[model samples]
Target: MSTFAKAGFKSANYNSFRPHYPPSFYKILTEYIGKEAGKTGDKVGKTIDLGCGTGVATYPLLQFSQNVVGLDLSPPMIETANSLKAAKLKELGIQDESRIEFGVCAVEDFDAPPNSYDLITAAECIHWFKDYPKFFEAAAKHLKPNGVLAYWFYVDPVVVNFEGPHNEKLLAIETMRRAQQIYLLYVYEDPKGLGVHWDRPGRDILRNLLREVDAQIPQDLFKDVKTQKYVPSVDGLLQLTPQDLRLVREKITLKDFTNYISTYSLFHNYSESTGAGAEFLEKMIQEFETELGWDREKTLLDLNWTSGYTFMRKSGE
Candidate 1:
């Protein structure tokens, strides 16, 4: 998270290139909240989004709640979120700007009155939080009885399928394997790659889909906890069921793909440390084009991410 707070970090690029959560996921969230609300006769109301960078997961909350507060530790990220407030609200057909607010604060330090929020969410960020037991306790303090607390994240995208020049799935499996290998080499295997640059434990926890965090949840404070993870097949692309939550999917070119990589915190650290960020990306793209025998501009890759979500309700007395 400190990487994002750096003066050199570009929150705009992050907002632009990051993949957004699909609308279907929100429907799942609504149902989860509604199911719990049915017991307590509480309506979905104020929501607080922790680690809400640029309001990506924050704005959509307005669909269910009247007031949403997006909090992040990064000032620049908060600034960008606030800057886009008017435009995003307009796009969402929202009239009032004050319906949602963005603030700068760590999730641990954020304070609210007891029973202040109907829903509390952390999008792509709970891994960065310290002390999961403490966090759940604090979240319980803020949530009304039967209120929902949810968090979800998508890790590195895997190339599952490809459309060749003749619109064929030719070499799709091989290409997918190679693309993923390249991703791993740069992000994990290569000694000089971005692997070592990542902030430890947090990144590892997130890569594992927050299982570590989920395990730390206190049953005394929260119940009806549900954790779902979409695991892509190692043999090839996974066949997504109708019941699956579509967390991340995109048909993108090599350039588009690399741009998304640039948004990674490890990329920033690698660039700063090695002073070869541009060269690193260019070489990686060149390797993809050369080995996969695909044109950077012409090739279209269907990418899917290994993603998961956790939902829980505050335990009632």
Candidate 2:
């Protein structure tokens, strides 16, 4: 993720790409924040989102607070977020229009007016912070007395059931897997030659951080979080004739796989950075064109499992 930003492609990709958090998730947040409001007598409090690219989390927080601030280092992202049309805002349930605000600033550089905020959220943005301990301490400073901090993230689910042999279904699963593998290779190769792209924390890290910071919550974010099984809807995408996927281990070529990899981010980035990324893809396509030598059009994808988890709290009265 940091590599993407370092490459000057953060906002470029963020504005057009990225998935929207489901409204169901926000409704749950509203309930939790409302609970805090009842105890503190703060009807609608100030909420801040750190590293809020395009305000994905900020726009959703509007239901829980009258004033929400989205701060990100990307100015272009801030601009794009502010100009979203009324229909777009309507989709986010942001009718008040003035409830949301976005700005260009790094979270570390921010100095909070003591106890001025009721809630703060860092959605998919915490990993980019340099000193996380200091960052959380700053978060603690901003809380309006016992204020809540929430973290939320998600990943695309992995598919396991598609693992048998070479049927149409198996072929589809294989295709997705191969694409993912190439993607991993592309990123791991240091496309932009940036420093390490920090790995995202899991439940264990979250627990350790909360403990180190002495932060407590009523609910365990991961207690109920479980990996939802992946059932491949492979029948939908492939337009190949019955003959293509019918035989056991029927051959396919590199060109076939490149088509799918092109749908991925790393492919695009690699194409831009390596200059030969497209040529490399073309080479793969040509290599796989022949079905005679050994096996062909072989695909295996890395099915990733992603989950969403959250825990919230209310500020002191």
Candidate 3:
């Protein structure tokens, strides 16, 4: 079984705590699709969101395509995705039930007609594919002429001192970094010389991010390759002033932060293997709280994260 399929994988927590792609990210995708639609004199057609865990990227995609298919290898992940479809659709004012579908299948094995999709997306999950060239070939096979293929992953967050006293914020950020290093050592380092083999694709992707994406996608098969970096401010229009940043901080709680950390595949795997994941996490959290002088009951962490994407059009447009 895959690490994502391991018992205790909390799909709900993953959905709740995972960082969402900003609205601007979705806007850019829709604008690209709209421009392509204009060239064809037809609205955007079908889409497939590869590795659409808990429908994070899949749900946002509904606005751009007539239908979307979210595919993942883990049954529980698919189940959680399907469970949210109706509510999300309703929330989005979508009346059609046929607009979205979730399936338990790896992208390699999922069947689709050639030239069927107008857009294909694999957000934060493409790095897990065992065969990049094969996956790219499959993607090309499924994309229509001029179709768009977009995928992206985020590196570690860029924490900023958005609030609190200047000295306290600096101290907190430093302590957070130290806590992270300790957690990484416990999870990734084979401490105690136990020869623990840590070969998780998700973990590798987290460490390498876009480098893995570049290594996987065949450059010859696509055209008009492009990329965009998403930060707290894009083009200075979305800049978060100190006050705005404070508002952003208010949305997250300590529980939300911990829940997000728990969703990492490394934590799940570590927990399953050694039964010490929770203890390790608790110790790390305590250390961070102590170092930052944060009250666990009231402190909210301000996580300043950045992300980016690379996209290309199918050749022969």
Worst 10 residues of 2 by lDDT: 242-251
Give the winner by TM-score: 1
Instruction: Provide the global lDDT of candidate 1 against the true structure.
Output: 0.84
lDDT of 2 by residue, 177-207 (tens): 5544443444344444211222434323432
> Which parts of model 2 have CA positions greater than 4 angstroms off?
1-13, 34-43, 85-87, 92-95, 156-183, 186-272, 276-305, 310-317
Q: How close is candidate 3 to the true structure, as a TM-score?
A: 0.83
C-alpha positional error of residue 230 in candidate 3 after TM-score superposition, expressed in Å: 5.8
Per-candidate TM-scores read 0.94, 0.60, 0.83
Task: List residue ranges in candidate 1 displaced over 4 A.
Answer: 35-43, 165-170, 234-237
Residue-level lDDT tens digits of model 3 in 99-194: 899998987788788999989999888767777788889889999988999987764443343333222655554655554554455445646311
Per-prediction RMSD in angstroms? 3.0, 10.0, 5.0
**Could you say which candidate leads in lDDT?**
1
User: Candidate 1 lDDT, tens digit per residue, 134-189?
Assistant: 89999999999998999998888888766654213435666677778999998888
Pairs of residues at least 3 apart in sequence or in different chains that clash in candidate 3: none
- Worst lDDT 10-window in candidate 1: 34-43
